[model samples]
Target: MTKSDFPALRMTIDGGRLVPAGPFDAERLNSYRRGTVVYVRFTEEKDRVLVRKWFAIIDIVLKQCQTPWKNRDQAHEAIKLALGIVNLSKTVGGDYMQYPKSITALEDPELQEALEQMTELLSRMTGVDVATLKKETAHIVEYEDHGPTTGEIIEHESGAASPDADEPPSSSSAGAAESPSSAAPTNTDTTETPVADLVSVETSGDGDAPTPSPGARDPETQRLIDFAKDVLPLAANTETTGSLLSAIEKEWAPEIKKMSADGQEKAKAISRSMRAIFNRQASLNGALDFFSDALGCSVEELGG
Candidate 1:
């Protein structure tokens, strides 16, 4: 529908976010119909002129992965990179919040599978070949010396480790193996390696994530990194967002403009949250002339 269909959510400028005001009831929970749009409003710094925009948490999360992941590893590379920046934003207590726990939790099969699904979906969504990162994962060497695949486990006993991954005729372990149909309990530990240990997005053989060319990335990219790290939390510095938008318009406008309506929206949604930060921060200066098509963040909010 239109903006009139959604309820209003007021977010105050605390420091670096647009936190909803109140005890976080139904209006703030976002558990209602997805169609229920929530428009955020901010009174101008000095003018008190009303500025409003839709604030969607799910949309923002989806936007971050739109950059066209190179693969699961590459996506996590970005995740690791982004996580480092987020951790840099410390509280007065001087402790880094363990954020985006995906880094540490990748070992969980469910998370790994979900991430893989996301990588594939996001790749197709952005039309960027991020799945190529699987090649880096393929290059890893695995050892089967720990235990046999869970399928080969014996009843009421842990799966035995194999000496070689390929040549596997352990004379002593012959009768211990059980058929898949066997109605016996099997061990938890098995040959299937943890995905996190098998493939690290944080490194490409050098044990470090990829780095942006200090001078090569556009000002928007640089500024976004700083903003995620909270270096510019108090101020979104919309000037930077405006510059990036101008650059995108100049370089990608014609091509992006020609894209399908859905494609155009996806492209525009790219890095919308970061733009919101700059826009919200710029509010401190009073009236703002610039706005991004990405996501909403016309004011900074800090939590207690």
Candidate 2:
């Protein structure tokens, strides 16, 4: 029988028995045999937006579930990512406040199955054992405030340590003290160094006297590291190399173009830099290297 021919399924909500509110459009009904519910068609604009948002949420959740580090922390991170996508899709879909309520109201088995699939996808993406994901979901439902904030959890997973504001400095701080004359110069001065000079410096000393990594170098490395840090948050939320590349392309397009004789070279340089950064070739150092190679200039020159 066709969707219109099939009788509308009845469901209860808020202690009231509610029948399917809208006309059953066959084309819109996606039926899942496992759950005898039929997903409704998007007749209203709000419903349409909800569908779009839900789709995006599902996509992100699925991707995260498939990630290799499946755990409560990872699940928490995935939820945060899904929530962010939900927020953005809400804006794109045009009904931000109504989403939660509408999602709660959906009774179609097909829709339920979709959500289930999303959860499963999340489990897979995160590399969390299925049993573990289920247990964590239940725990999250029970706990009120244990859930970590998106920023906190994501930063942790990304290898950034949270600053403990309440804790006092450790005794080691006493030994680490340096006189003003010995103190390092401001970041601005360091970031302006030429790429050639940056490459010339050894990133490390002998094993006994280890030195700071590339990120600890002068201002140019520091600046790029800062830029990479900002991009991590954005990347976790949406597609593309976080959003830095997009911003740079838009904001610096004119300046970048003016630098090259025909602008094509500048465009190529920007593209190369983006690929290197997003691919995680070698962290911020690699990004700088890519830029230097593209521009045929030293890192010091770029900084200057």
List ranges where model 1 is wrong by over 4 Å. Answer: 1-79, 82-90, 93-102, 105-235, 238-257, 260-269, 272-304
Which ranges in model 2 have alpha carbons more than 4 Å from their true place? 1-241, 259-263, 281-283, 293-304
Report RMSD (Å) for each prediction in the order shown: 21.4, 20.7
Q: What is the C-alpha lDDT of each candidate?
A: 0.32, 0.34
The lowest-lDDT stretch of 10 consecutive residues in candidate 1 is: 48-57
Q: Please provide TM-scores, in order, for all candidate models, with all chains considered together.
A: 0.22, 0.19
- Report the C-alpha lDDT of model 2 over 1-304, residue by residue, as the tens digit: 5645443333223455344323332222335355675464322211322233333333333232222223333333333232221122245666332111234345556454445444443332232333433332221111111112211111111122225211211122132111121133534553332221223223234412122355455443333333433343333232665456678556645644444232333344334434433543223343344333322334454442
Residue-wise lDDT of candidate 1 within 6-116, one digit each (tens)? 334335546896664544323645555777665545553211101000001112222222233333333333433321212224558974333333333333464444344
Model 2 lDDT, full chain set: 0.34
What TM-score number comes out for model 1? 0.22
